[model samples]
Target: MNNSVFRRLLLPGVIVLAGCSGSTDPETAHLFDNVKNLNNGEYDRQIASKDAEAAAIVRQNNAASARISTLRNQSASNSAEIKALTSQISSLRAQTSSLRGKFSNQPDKLAQLNQLDGQLVQIRADVGAGTSPSVARAELNRVSAAIRALSR
Candidate 1:
């Protein structure tokens, strides 16, 4: 009977001691908390890096768009100038052709006609090399007046 009583008491004490003997080492005790904090910090750093990359991409896209817009505006202006120059060139050609037809049959005006032809050739070269329309028009008027004087 005494042995049975002692056995029962000792068993309860052993269980109590086992339950109280949890991990006492500081590193081991807080291992899980430390791991959780480290993971959270890594996630925050990754998010910040992604945000910076996204902002840089946005800035690059805006810069490219601005360059494209500038190019488009310049192209439009160049096209308009080209159109005006073409019209002026056409008018000058018609006037020159008319003047040539007037002097083709007159033997006495042959020298004057030749000089006018040389002038016309030079004007055409200047126009082709990007002379201003206003200057080209003035030259054309001078040639027309010279042809008229020769005819008279």
Candidate 2:
């Protein structure tokens, strides 16, 4: 009976002591570092993917910004052209009015002045109707030539 009890107790104590032995082997310690490095590698890949996506978004935003700047520049240019055209039209109308008074006494001169006035009115209407700046400028130049000829 004493031998049986001693055997049972000793067997259980040996098992407990063996399990408690410290794991000091180099291979066992390096296993933990290997697992940590693998997890770090996966984290690095995820970071790279996110950075690439963010860079693509930034590129798209830059393109959009450039397009917006181009549109604004075009709008400003159009506005300036319209303003200049309006000024030219006003000046031409004044010249026509002045010529009309000067030529009222002569029938031939009056008819030429009337024709020049008609051309001015037509060009004004074309400009108001959104004619391109080049076309409107060409027509204004033609009218100005006529007015100069009539004055002579």
Question: Highest TM-score among the candidates is held by which one?
Answer: 2
Q: lDDT per residue, candidate 1, 50-78, as tens digits?
A: 89999999999999999999999987976
Scanning candidate 1 in windows of ten residues, the lowest lDDT window is: 21-30
Question: How accurate locally is residue 102 in candidate 2, as Cα lDDT from 0 to 100?
Answer: 88
RMSD list, candidates in order = 12.2, 10.8
CA lDDT, candidate 1, residue 18: 54
The TM-score between candidate 2 and the true structure equals 0.65
lDDT of 2 at 123: 80
Model 2 CA deviation exceeding 4 Å by range: 1-43
**Residue range with the least summed lDDT across 10 consecutive positions in model 2:** 21-30
Which pairs clash in the backbone of model 1?
A: none
